[model samples]
Target: MKRQVIVYKMEGSIVRRVIPSDNSCLFNAVGYVMDHDKYKAAELRQVIAATVASDPTKYSEAFLGKSNEEYCSWILNPEKWGGAIELSILADYYGREIAAYDIQTTRCDLYGQEKKYRERVMLIYDGLHYDALAMSPADGAPEEFDQTIFAVNPDRTIGAYESLALNLVKDQQRKRSYTDTANFTLRCGVCQIGVIGQKEAAEHAQATGHVNFQEYK
Candidate 1:
């Protein structure tokens, strides 16, 4: 889908900052919101690794689906992608709540919400990739003037902001903005082998040691 800027009523415009799809989009997205730098993937990976290494019981094998050592090592790899666990850790580390909106499901998963963080950031997950959400002063305003972090409160302002985000997501959904990973076709970039869906892609990768795959319409 073509990149587009969405307006959020009279307050400002809700824009999606397209992050690089280098398998580190999640980290890059988080970095963009936190520091306005999308190239901090390596540093974010180290942050996750150090956080996991510092506490094993809290991030055990049962919860991480792998040993603490293995998980930390895997997370540090630039090819490895971060997900819910990384989001949770980063939320606590940065002392802010993260609200990730899934384009496929229109569901908002709020991490560190129970901790009652004073601020929150937003992200958009399109099945396989992640992008950050920021509010600009105008529909075509420069991103440097965008506001990525928002205050979290019990007042209606927070509710209105969330509503605007949801509406933007719904608008994207109508434009077919998300990838349907379950049915999307992928081609092995290394061997030019055709694969269907994420399950088949993983199987093909494990069987042929081809880690490069690209989605094809």
Candidate 2:
């Protein structure tokens, strides 16, 4: 993928590579940063399922918000979305910190930060989607030549790279790039019933088994 890059104050341009809008966007975004392959979503899902299954105590029902068996099965489902738990597990598995910058709140959630990982990768979360952040050599460089993994100092400081990411996220926020899931209007694709917010969408799905929804402006 060749995306137009955003020039940061640093040497190269930092760009957000848009991941597919499929349900596996989070996994694909992580995979893109880890190995430059977006198609590893299925493999990553399997890894998450296996990792959770291997340790019931660490990933207990109280922690996972569901039974271990059920959570494992649910994570393996293609429609299910990956979140904080999956990010932490994958961060441990890869031995790198995953910094997820939210455009909605301009908050950076660092997974595996406590482990003191030497390397870190960035992901942009727009409330409803995840995109990989990479540093390209130039403004129009190809994504294959971009650098996704960055080094963190032993003292836990990332220097200018982290600032670059946060600035980019702030720019996106200024542009209203994030979806406000709590207030966004959605229409069920199954029955065409209008819904407000993710809570209502989930409730409608549970009550009437309508899972497909599209956001409307």
Candidate 3:
């Protein structure tokens, strides 16, 4: 069998590659970044609603333009999405500095929260969509990027990420996105032989009719 390679170059170092399986990309991105895996848009909406409601003095219309009732309804609706609003509430809740990166320019763009000394996390934007990127585990692949930090500031803008800078996002776009995998082993459950990655795992499964797969620590 032939080997599938992930093309990687020096641009912006990504911590981890999170593919958006659904519209919950923004929520998933945030969850994956903070070690917070709660990805339901409605559940996320509820969390923020309660937080904002508890303190109208801190979370104001400046942050939430719509009334609490209306805002809650909007986020709960699957059609409505999450972005900076959700990021800010979460940053405040977690007491971390969330950095929002505008990939178009090589700068560490806007951030959430005014207070300094907070730990940082990353959030990426293509001008229309949002996703999460973080540092790979210590035992991960692409050794060069193991310690890359993705600190972002929390900021909100509608329709701001519609236009993506291909050059900036090329690394995390598709199959190539798996470029830097953390140190783990993908083994074929049937053969007990180790394979390199997802493609190999799929090919091995197809050729040997082995559907069972496992990842080892």
Q: How high is the CA lDDT of each candidate model?
A: 0.90, 0.92, 0.57
Q: Best to worst by lDDT, what's the order?
A: 2, 1, 3
Per-residue lDDT of model 1, residues 1-217, tens digit only: 9999997556786788999999999999999998999998999899999999999999899999999999999899888888999999999989999999999889999999888888999999988999999988887888899899999877513656788889889988888899898899999999998988889998997798888889897
Q: Which is better, 2 or 3, measured by TM-score? A: 2
Which lDDT tens digits does candidate 2 get at residues 163-202? Answer: 7888899999999999999999999998999999989998
The whole-model C-alpha lDDT of candidate 3 against the native structure comes to 0.57
Superposed Cα deviation of residue 79, candidate 2 (Å): 0.9
**Candidate 1, position 174, lDDT:** 88
Model 1 is weakest, by summed lDDT over 10 consecutive residues, at: 153-162
Candidate 2 CA-lDDT value: 0.92
TM-score of candidate 2 to 2 decimals: 0.93
Among the numbered candidates, top TM-score falls to 2
What order do candidates take by TM-score, descending?
A: 2, 1, 3
Q: Who wins the lDDT comparison?
A: 2
Q: Candidate 3 has what TM-score?
A: 0.52
Clashes of 2: 0
